[model samples]
Target: MKQLIVEIDETTEARIIIAAKTAGLSAQQWLKRIIDEKTVSSWPDSVKALAGSWQDVPFAEELRSGEGREKTY
Candidate 1:
């Protein structure tokens, strides 16, 4: 596994230590869990179900197709 280093203020470090203790994990483990959560590659179900749902809306193609640029004088 690769290693990473981060520099944080004393107050923030203290907060992480306290949070780790509350969750019964070491500070390194708690930080790793947070990084894993933020790096997940999956989207939520609500957003996944919205695919192609707006294709039929009025002028949706013209508004989003990037083909109509304003002419400058």
Candidate 2:
């Protein structure tokens, strides 16, 4: 197998570690499984605050109905 080197930020490295632990795997194994096209056993645990009011029931319903969902960043 060919060896590859990847450079990432510290935050990303931390996330990788979290993801690896979530799947009960080492970082190398996690990356290898990803490269092998296996489904990720655990998702990365990052939370983002969505823009919405607590009482915005209508807006929440609209969002859930696929009315105002963003495709991606």
Candidate 3:
């Protein structure tokens, strides 16, 4: 594991400590979780689980079929 050194103002450091405490995590754990969330490349599980959930919504192809679009000259 690599060690990271950051220089933050006292107020910011206090805020991070407070936030970590509120989340029931150490500052390091909270920061690691935040970094992981920020660096993620794929959709989170909660969002992926929403796929095919909106049965009434039109698909991309249906919306692009130009059914109600105005004709151009």
lDDT (C-alpha, whole model) for all candidates: 0.90, 0.78, 0.96
Off by over 4 Å in 1: 44-73
Q: 20 in model 1: Cα distance from truth in Å?
A: 0.4
Model 2 has an lDDT value of 0.78
lDDT string for model 2 (1-73, tens) is 7899999999999999999999999999998988776665554444224434356466655667865667775
Q: Return the clash pairs for model 2, or none.
A: none
Model 3 lowest lDDT segment of ten: 62-71
Of the two candidates 1 and 3, the one with more favorable lDDT, higher being better, is: 3
TM-score of each: 0.56, 0.46, 0.72
Q: Is candidate 1 or candidate 3 better by TM-score?
A: 3
Order of all candidates by TM-score, from best down to worst? 3, 1, 2
Ranking by lDDT: 3, 1, 2
In order of listing, the candidates' clash counts read: 0, 0, 0
Residue 40, model 1: lDDT of 84
